[model samples]
Target: MDKIIRIGTRSSKLALWQANTVAEQLGHFGHKTEIVKIDSIGDIVLDKPLYELGITGVFTKNLDIALLNGEIDIAVHSFKDVPTKLPEGIVQAAVLKRGDFNDVLVIKEDENFFTKDAAIIATGSLRRKAQWLYRYPHHTITGLRGNVITRLQKLEDNDWDGAIFAAAGLKRLKLLPEKEKHIKLDWMIPAPAQGAVMIAALEKDEDILEACKEINHEETATCVGIERDFLRVLEGGCTAPIGALAMIFDEEIKFKGTLFSPDGKNKMEFYKEVPVNNATDLGEYGANYILERGGKKLMREVHDIEKSTLVYSTKSLSHDQTNNLSSKIGVTSSDFITIRNNRLKRVIVKKPIKNALFTSQNAVEALLNNFSRVELDFENIYCVGRRTKRLIEKKIGKVTHIENNSEKLADYLVKNLDTKEVTFFCGDKRMDDLPTTLLNNYFIVNEVECYQTQLTPRLIEDKYKGILFYSPSGVESYLKENTANEIVAFCIGETTAKKAKDHFKNVVVSKLSTVESVIKSVNDYFQE
Candidate 1:
């Protein structure tokens, strides 16, 4: 405490503000602090985006090196810029209380960009770029790389309609424009520990570490810990397009995370909340939730975007499935629907049930994912599709009945089902025909939503020779960002083919209702 703590920070005004704030906080504890300015690779490279630099902790590495050499007792950094894993011999000393984590849009013109068909928005961060595009797919995004002031100046010199920035930075430096000129993007999730400042110290330096702990905010630390854990589990580091934010309230912690492809074409996201005691691994669990559903494959696509593909699957496929296709037809895939088991766990039945129904494989997987086959048993399993029935038989039990579509399934259930009560496992966006029919037939339909399906529409930059759609939802998700009237539409069944016919000039339905059939149909069409 008696030694003067040397605080290393980037030379940018925003970083200096962080350092001076740290120095002021340390001063109150009777620890003398000296500000040592440092230049980071991020500051030196103004022409390239941070992700393009291909370096981890570009803004904090220089200061970290200074700390490692004992030139500075502690290194200050915008917590988001710090890698989830610290450098060797470096440990986090403190995390100050977080500031405004909302991203703000500084508009050079009016606020009509959202309604317009096309408008130019600028930002250097890939996370921001992707989120903006996901919301405004019709709008144009341009790159602007520099420090806060420099980026603002570039906006002034350019013809962009608006640019994005962290509200904490503009508010900390009192550079936030008037309310009319700027709007808060409340929907945008901030980077991990975005508005917080971090103090890094040598693990052996007990004095500095001890002194810094006095300024550590435990609540901020917990929230940022969750956010950073989510980021680390995603394995994106700083180079990928990822965003995460965590907040605590009323003895409960809430978290939200989003992952995007490198080109910002595809997106995956999850949100969860838990009691304070159960919040420790919530971030890790959330990341795993998406990964199991489809995120792992999407990230692989992001990492290998340079590879060209002639076919794009709205749903992710297994290694064998992709290899099932001829190597001559390169395929790229991502799950357009993010499947989540939020309702699956709570709605699981531990007791034996007479009649159970599944409309899609997603419902079967979602139910089995949270509740094991040993947990519950069903006497009669009636599913709308063969694949769904097969999954039920493989994972849980035998399927007594199977139908091609919901209407047929409803007719079969009404005529054959004698049970007064039936439980239907399905996603959030299921058609109401089966449930309505059962209800009208005086049956107690327990429509337990086993999973929630969210559509993640990604832009398809190039039209392939053909587009393969497994369901009407897949076709709808694809049409959100692309038109395929001229491209061949290979569908798994007549239901999917009917949907494709509305959007495409040519539609081909597989002879069988299966993915293998769809693939073979595609091969046959291209072969001809």
Candidate 2:
């Protein structure tokens, strides 16, 4: 009896179809297969943009986790969602035959919207958004996220003129609408591996590798490999408006790639055809062609729309996350800091702790991931910032003490705390102000480093009226690559404001220490 090969995939219809196709392909080679459904962060998170989340291969992360843990023998994935670089222990098993590699715009009605001066288009992709804006500068671009079925339904449901989607996904799922309803964006370059399905498996699985090799399409693999190699050089742990497509002719492979600013006003493009014999290093060669020119500078300068009242945030935020901001003003953000829970630190938290101190929302979230709200409902819950307090109140219990900054929180704790000792949960990069003050006051403080924060500063290519900042570290990160001397700084609190005042011309601290307060400060400052 043959051992059943387990295929892992997202529970979505497209993913299921891909998995079944792989299973059937494997079965053809005298191998039995089983489909294993796995949940991915990309599928669960519909609110945040993929790039802003600071996660590489958001769609493949969970699947990779599952694969690493031996939950499945193989994982079928949309190749484009997989990062250019594979995880260390995982290797690509096969690339299926290519499909129609073009983006389609599912329109609401007639083509009249295209001829109009201002139209509304929706897409979740940064590449699609930039290309569309380049072609139609006057058009408004809204975010649309979900599976193929959900997106098609959204196109019909929303008042927008159209929404962009992959033609291959629609065709694969049989979700493509009538010919009159959708238009193929022939001019736009598709993402690397856009229409390809890839099978990934553990590096040491010899039997799985041999089984998958039977289904691999050499031509498809070659084309996508070059395209992915191009992407690997250009995108280094960051997302950008980048697009590439590679085609194999009889004797030669032709490739075209373009990089654009976030708003698509500035672009760098390159096209090259290399003989099939010498095409192994074509991707790296072509990418260098763009980088040596203006591509490097252009990547750094992708700016916000200048004419509009745009505010750039150092942290990634969805429009819904900030209900306080008006629709008239455009808000674009990319996270400058990445935070993750520390697994080792989580273990240090024991039950029935009398008192707790949280400096940031990340710390609270990290601690809660290990200990539930009921278990963490201490006699006294002390935290800094209103948002942190709000989260505690909603999830855990009441906040006995809250302040805008660690300095203030420490001050409050010094005078009011009847308990001689407290456990403080914080990130690795947390400021030492509070800890220093506590120890100096002779208070016994047990600190648990629950999370870690890393700065990932990016260039702000376009001019904005103001920039919103949530942390002093964010300000430091932004200054590493770019400057905002002429613009106003909208800071979440006084500590962040202090950092901004050193760089920005006008620094406005929020009346209260919260994301909403910072937005309100922006509106109020403009109103005044």
How close to the true structure is residue 49 of candidate 1, measured as C-alpha lDDT? 41
User: Per-candidate RMSD vs. true structure?
Assistant: 13.6, 17.0
TM for every model, in the order presented, reads: 0.56, 0.55
Instruction: Score candidate 1 by TM-score against the native.
Output: 0.56
Each candidate's clash count: 0, 2
Residue 303 error, candidate 1, Å: 5.1
In model 1, what are the clashing residue pairs, if there are any? none
Question: Worst lDDT window (10 residues) for model 1?
Answer: 41-50
Query: On residues 339-405, what C-alpha lDDT tens digit does candidate 2 reach at each position?
Result: 8887753346445667888988898888777777655647788988778899989888888888878
lDDT of 1 by residue, 1-528 (tens): 678899999888899999999999999989999999877423242334434432245677678767766778999989988887776677999999999999999999889867878899999888888889888888888988888898999999999999999999999999999989999999988888889989989899988889999999999999999898888777777677788988889999889988887566788999988888778887777776676567866663354333333777777654446657764676666777777775455435867888998888988888877787888778888887678778888889888988877778889888987776898888787743788988899999887877887778888756477788888888888888887857888887776787888889999988767788788887777666
Displacement of the residue 350 alpha carbon in candidate 2, Å: 80
Q: What TM value does model 2 have?
A: 0.55
